[model samples]
Target: MSDANKKAIRTAIQTGIGVAAALPMIVAASGVPAALPWVAGALAVAGGVARVMALPVVQALLPSWLRTDSSASRR
Candidate 1:
């Protein structure tokens, strides 16, 4: 697939992950009960994503805009 397509997929995945991580916190902070389970699930998902992101192959998939090096060639 093209770089732009890959970048869009990556962005959408990360946005979903961000929303998943935030939902539990928002619920808990709002004084909702039974949020512990949701928090635990979100934590697990975040941890798994973090580990996957640390992989060299996964890092290679990251968009240039999201890279720490910030040295992408300009056209």
Candidate 2:
């Protein structure tokens, strides 16, 4: 797969994992499931690992898309 695709997929996975880890914690503390904390911790760690593995591969293959201008063109 291309670098751009890999980067985007990694980003999406990271976002999903973060949300999964947060939602349960935001629920009623008294209603919290016994396994909620473990699930969240697992997701966070998985996402972190995926990021560590995918980011360098993507960055190395992708090119910079940003632009810089010291001054704007006179119009």
Compared with the true structure, all predictions reach lDDT values of 0.66, 0.56
- Candidate 1 residues lying further than 4 Å off, grouped into runs, are 1-11, 20-35, 69-75
C-alpha positional error of residue 72 in candidate 1 after TM-score superposition, expressed in Å: 12
For model 2, the stretches where C-alpha displacement exceeds 4 angstroms are 29-75
Q: Give per-residue CA lDDT, model 1, range 38-72, as digits (tens).
A: 76677677667666666666556667666443333
- Tens digit per residue, CA lDDT, model 2, 39-63: 5576566657646544544544444
Candidate achieving the largest TM-score: 1
Worst 10 residues of 1 by lDDT: 66-75
Clashing pairs in 2: none
